[model samples]
Target: MSTTTREAAGRCPRCGAAVHGDGRFVVWCAACDWNVDPAPPDEDRGRPARVRRALARRHGEHLLAETTDGGAPGPRRDPAALAAYAIALLVHGVTVVLAVGGTWFLVTGWGRPLMAVGLFLLALAWTLRPRPHRPPEDGTPILARADAPELYALIDEVAGVVGTRGADLVVVDAGVNASVTTCGVRGRRLLTLGLPLWEILTPQQRIALLGHEFGHYSNGDARHGRVLATAYRSLTTWRYYFAPAPDPSLLDLLVNLLSLPPRAVVHGVLALLDQLTLRATRRAEYLADSAAARAGSTEAAVGLMDRLLVADSAMTTLRREGNAAQVVRRGTEAGDRADGLWERLVADTESIPEGEYERQRRVGALRGHSVDSTHPPTHLRRARLLSATPVPAAVAMTGGRARAIAAELAATRRTVARHIVRHGFPG
Candidate 1:
């Protein structure tokens, strides 16, 4: 379902190694890293995107340098982090002011119009209020502790290694990624494990993934905290409400012109937040990777990075399989075609050669691919894991336990396969 073509290119200018490309991707030396961070594509050529990229690169470089110099990442009180918290508080303060003003108008209004104004203000306050994160109601299965005790036991062991609580819920979905986040007002931990990614990982790499997620909690990642995170979300919601409509009508243009000042203020606050938290968040990721290394050994953590580097390939394989089922529908039901999709995806991902991994690493360097903009570059993460002091795995998995976990997930895998068949894999 997945294929690659390769041909020799010129020698690397830096290392004299024979460079190669498929004529479709970048050609670069995997040995000495020449042309790896070439000029990025035109899609990100906008001034705002360029600025974000520059800030991200600077943050990553500085943090990587600090860690390489033997600095261990812990919660540090920096002015930037303080400023970020201040701005977040200021945003929440605005919502509170709106609520108070609305309530005052409602209670003391002398006339109907004043009461209507109060109602409008209250609506605005509600719209701008900070919200806690919640799990999506998209029918993705959520497994409780009793449903998968052995799997929960494994996660609990990894959580202990990372000095955090195990997930309260295990969510399965048709994705090629995994993450841990808190949900709802109580800050309940939830592990959203992507079946496609889980299927391809070795038992140890799975431990590393869990460790990296739990590390977010142990390392005090501000983005995972409701206070700052909800503030960011509130600001984003404000920005969205003020954003100019695409293909604007005259009325829309008038609204945009009238709202320009507040919009500018919101944009400025958002930019300030990004600047303040950029360094802290990026460092949190590096520290989380360290936790992964501590939990599952440096080798497994680095292997996890390699798998992430080629995640696009895994998704492509899923897309191909899904597409094949549709294109070759020879009187077969969707369920018939969806059967064993996860198995095929696992096979395809495992069949990737070591050479392909190298190419992807180079490509990741070239494109500055990361889990997201909040994260440092994948190349940097992999490099840090390799350069950091190695630690033996604190949590090891036996074959029997691994099989039991798989058995627990078997029904969920079937559900995910059906969802993928109907919706295809998410991009």
Candidate 2:
């Protein structure tokens, strides 16, 4: 009779244990240590209530409520929008001027068709520009199963508040920074994290970092970035095309000579336009940091900023060391050969650092060597993050939900680091 009763109660699919009814669609099985369901449960019907009960068991109802309610306003895009608008106007004005001026000169017959073809090609390039690819499979899968579920849950919760799609998650083996990318038209969004970044940040700090990245997604920055990049490329193409080619024809020569003044004027206008665009990009970074603060605690955001600076410093040190090693190796190989002028010069340089202490001194000097860098200095980024104000409660309440998801990402770095140490790099 007992066996019959046990069989009547559905067993957990995973553990094969008998289950008892939980009033909701779920049945709890103590023996199997799992919940079993005959059918998919409706999330809207009882999930929230069940979740509330579960949270209450762990954190108490008050703490749970506080966590659910506590949020800061996300960063505002007003400055970015205004800057973008200004750039658009500048671009439009320049384009109009170029079109009109080019048309006027097109009376030379050869110039007219060439200019038109050039403009068409530029437009095509903008429209068909390729996007950056997803990080390769050889990259790290930073987040493990245990961490990923929690992270996804947090993302779902936050996405509800923001009324937007949660970021798509990916982990790259590259030890570096994190960035969010977008794909698809309206509903699809992709977010990627670097394994090195995951390894370095604590849970709260990770949450803060993710908040900033998602803020960019929520603000539609990906779309805006794409537009800006495409437009910039298109403009460059147009500028090149309309530029005068070497001409033997007298009429072409005359037109080219006359066009020089207008072209110079256009160049200045474009420079102003470029400045505006760059200013907007800088402002966007500030806004994203503010968004991070709003989504998580200001303290968490600040911590993340600090960690990022530390990581960047570490990377810089590594790169310098690698460069020094290469230089020394090259110098040694050249000395062994003793064949050419270049080799002799390198051998002589290597001879200058004869002892360990002298080599160390040389390496130390090389540390100060300045290489042209693409991004702004880390100090500037840190200063900006520090100076930024905390996001408003109202904005945080809705915008900051994604912060919790980042908290779940804390374990990812450890898993990735372990794998990396054990397996070496994924090829």
Q: Which candidate is the best by lDDT?
A: 1
Which portions of model 1 miss their true places by more than 4 Å? 1-49, 247-251, 328-333, 369-372
Number of colliding residue pairs in each model? 0, 8
lDDT for each residue of candidate 1 in 1-427, tens digit (9 for 90 to 100): 3344456578888878887765434566778777665655455553344556667866677678997676456656588888888888999999999999999989888476788888888999998888876787988899999999999998999999888889999898888889897788788988999888888888899999999999988987777777798898888898888888889999999998999999989878887777788778888888899889888889999999999988877888888776776665544666875777877777777766566677666666666633255788788899988887788999998899988998998889888887777666666
lDDT per residue (tens digit) for residues 1-427 in model 2: 0101112356667777655442312344445434322333233333323433333233322322332243323334555456655665465555555555555444444555666755654454444343333444654564543556656655554444333556555554545577766544442455566655654565556666767776665654422455454445545555565577685489888877877876665455445444444433433454556566665666777667656534533344324333333454444543232222222222322222122222222322232112211122333434454555554322232334445554564454345434433333332
> CA lDDT, every prediction?
0.81, 0.46
After the best TM-score superposition of candidate 1, give how far the Cα of residue 280 lies from its true spot, in angstroms. Answer: 0.5
lDDT of 2 at 368: 19
Stretches of candidate 2 above 4 Å error? 1-147, 156-164, 169-171, 184-187, 219-225, 236-270, 316-427
| TM-score of candidate 2 versus the correct structure, residues matched by position | 0.45
TM-score of 1: 0.89
Compare the candidates by TM-score and give the number of the best one.
Answer: 1
